[model samples]
Target: MYVAVKGGEKAIDAAHAWLAEERRGPEDVAELSVDQIKGQLKLAVNRVMAEGSLYDPDLAALAIKQARGDLIEAIFLIRAYRTTLPRFGGSEPVDTEAMACDRRVSATFKDAPGGQVLGPTFDYTHRLLDFKLAADGEVPSAPERAEAPETKPHIMSFLDREDLIQPEPEGAETPPDLTREPLELPAARPLRLQSLTRGDEGFILGMAYSTQRGYARNHAFVAELRIGACAVEMGIPELGFAIELGEVELTECETVNQFQGSKTEPPQFTRGYGLVFGMCERKAISMALVDRALRWKELGEDNVGAPAQDEEFVLYHADNIQATGFLEHIKLPHYVDFQSELELIRKLRREAMGQVRQEAAE
Candidate 1:
């Protein structure tokens, strides 16, 4: 068995070399630099970073290059590389309320505070593709800043002031880290949020869409969606003070759901929240809806047997790395496993045939 496994070592090495060569593509074409991927293919980098649970755009870009533009594979590389990194102290909770707004919009209010800043959005644009991009080498003019960047307050506060929305009390000061600890059943909101944020975009989006299609629909409305940069700060235990680490682009979505009233308390609008890495507006919005759907039990709402409402189902399968590993393992050598199954099937067939003959004779 050992020799048989070792015999394929040369073939595996050769296959890897061939894959590397193929990843480079035609020699005539200029190679895609990691910087190019980081700058130009920023959205792809963001997806990789988000799903991989890593924040380094440069590393994500290099992974994309090495993976030959396969985003999932790039994310896989990023996730694998992340395990080798040393653990540093956690950063302080980001202040999304004071984010330097790049793109901010509110579906519930037209004339929201700080005004509707539609920064680099395709909301109004036609779906038709621009041939100019296909022609290539044409540099579009740089986008001009309408005014200086400034911090803006979240729109959820507006509803909160009137006592129309449910109040969000603080959770544990030190929340559980999903990466370090095994996921426990009936996960808290923080753990669920972590899984959703680091979850696959397509999977999250699909689950959110299911809710809209009447699978535990929460009647979620986008109270506000903001994409901007927020400063990260962490406390140094030695210094007994905090220092700014750096700024990270984030997209936050807060949704005001249907009114929740009971016999004891007056009706107030419930809310769902999503905060994701970079300008992933769609993912953020989807996350908020799913978050709301999953909160059915906590919100005094009936469990409608929806897939999104199943916490165990969502968290367990949301991880692409785990899903891919289990799924991809089928392709590997399973000779012994298959042979046993094959023999069992043959014996079952023979027994069935014998029984048929016996019955006929009777």
Candidate 2:
């Protein structure tokens, strides 16, 4: 019942040629440059870098160009490329306290140490289309500010000192790497956070929104959301000291959520943390909310069967590449299976018709 399709190789080559031509579009239009994409389509590059778990902007921009403006495909390309690279050593955990922040804001406090610098945000921008931009698009430069402070204490430290928030215990045990190892059920906080950080932005956003709509609602207040550059350090075994490994732009979000008190414990605020590779505030915030919601088991909260609270559901379905590959695989040849199904249906129909004919004769 299975028939083999011929000329697949020639068909594929012809299709690829057509695709190359399509990617370039009309010959009159200027082809997109990687640098132009990197500078102008920054948010696309940022999303790719953040989700791909790689911070090379140039490469991300190249992937964007090759993927034809599909950010998820760009992320997939980056991720695939990342797997082939050699691993040196792991960098030290970044010190966000000493981050040279470009943008720092606190919704919990009226006055923060950095004084709420709203640097380069589209939050207040109107949605109106500017026709002038189509003719000659040039963004005006922003007014310069004084040099940022070298160090600023975290807003959570104040609550930490008062024991008002659940204490995060530091452990010497190395956390499990989800990228290296297969994911297991009842994931630890580190694994959960890793999964959430690399998860699809829209899927995580939808899950976070579900939490807000009373599916395991955790009243979350954005304690601090900071976007800035932080120095990464790596210990050199030969040098016997840690050395700086350049800086990376990060968007760190800390959400303070409602608490529950048990017989032995007093009511204290809980924390949801999110740290991403680029200046992606919305993704970071959504990751934080979903992170908090998924901590239901450890926090001694009831399982309200929320999508955000389901670790197996969230972690498995959150990888866009995996989801896309499986979804798109349907377009591939299914003739054999379809033929088998058709044969089965026909046989069943034949049997049913034969029975009807016999009954009529009787």
Q: Which 10 consecutive positions of candidate 2 have the poorest summed lDDT? A: 144-153
Candidate 2 lDDT by residue in tens digits, 180-216:
8999988888988888899999999999999999998
Name model 1 segments beyond 4 Å from true: 1-4, 143-151, 263-265
Q: What digit string (tens of lDDT, one per residue) describes model 1 on residues 1-362?
A: 22244468889899999999999999999998999999998999999998988988899999999999988888899999999999878998999888988899999999887889899887999999889888886787967856655546788898999999989869998899899999998999999999999998999999999999999988899999999889999998889999998999999999999956754446889889898998898999999999999987777788889999999988899889889989999998888778889999999999999999999999
**Distance (Å) between predicted and true CA of 316, model 2?**
0.5
Clashes of each: 0, 0
* lDDT scores of the candidates, listed in order: 0.90, 0.89
